[model samples]
Target: GAGIKSLFGGEITQYVTMMEESRDEALQRAIEHAKDLGANGIIAIRFDSNEISDVMQEILVYGTAVVVEKE
Candidate 1:
């Protein structure tokens, strides 16, 4: 898996995929948390990624939770 990453140039496919997966998971968790708070929507969503260790990465996602009314 790691061997299929990249050897030539710019974007590494495997790393990109990993980051995408991580971000998606974090976003899902954030959404679930907002849902638990009875939020009907989320706004100003933001994401940040950091390599915490040589073999670990962390993805952080946050947003403002809001309730939408059928006014």
Candidate 2:
């Protein structure tokens, strides 16, 4: 495994969607977070879920935002 660290979190009003789309949304959020931090890349990314309510849910996206040095 590469050097890894958890980073960023995003939650939206759990819109029911296909699994693949959900993953995309989470990935987008994570990527945006990294971009905000001026990170060149993110590694060791992971996702998680939490039941906010019977009707509402939350998604957490995390990754290691890395400043890649160009040689």
Candidate 3:
């Protein structure tokens, strides 16, 4: 599919959608984990992506969890 599409060389929307979904999933999981740790907020968030293979990809997110209090 991609091999043929690459000949034209334009935006690959399918891959865009897939990667967006992956990034959202990774971010949501990170938020859930921070919640589990009783964190009221997160700081210094960052994301990274990698290609394990032609078809396989990885999306990861990490941050510092912090408890915020109203003064």
Model 3, backbone clash pairs (residues 3+ apart or across chains), number:
0
Give the candidate order by descending TM-score.
3, 1, 2
Where is model 3 more than 4 Å wrong at Cα? Answer: 1-7
lDDT of 1 by residue, 23-65 (tens): 8899899989999999978999999878789999898997999
For residues 24-68, write the lDDT of model 3, one tens digit per residue: 899889889999999988999999988899889899898999999
**In candidate 3, which residue pairs get closer than 3 Å at backbone N, Cα or C atoms, i.e. clash?**
none
Q: Which numbered prediction scores highest in lDDT against the true structure?
A: 3
Error of 2 at 23 (Å): 2.8
Q: Where is the poorest 10-residue window by lDDT in model 3?
A: 1-10
Superposition-based RMSD of candidate 2 using all C-alpha atoms, in angstroms = 11.5
The best-first sequence of candidates by lDDT reads 3, 1, 2
Could you tell me the TM-score of candidate 1?
0.82
RMSD of 1: 4.0
TM-score of each predicted structure versus truth: 0.82, 0.63, 0.85
Better TM-score candidate (1, 3): 3
> What would the TM-score be for candidate 3 when compared with the true structure?
0.85
lDDT of 3: 0.84
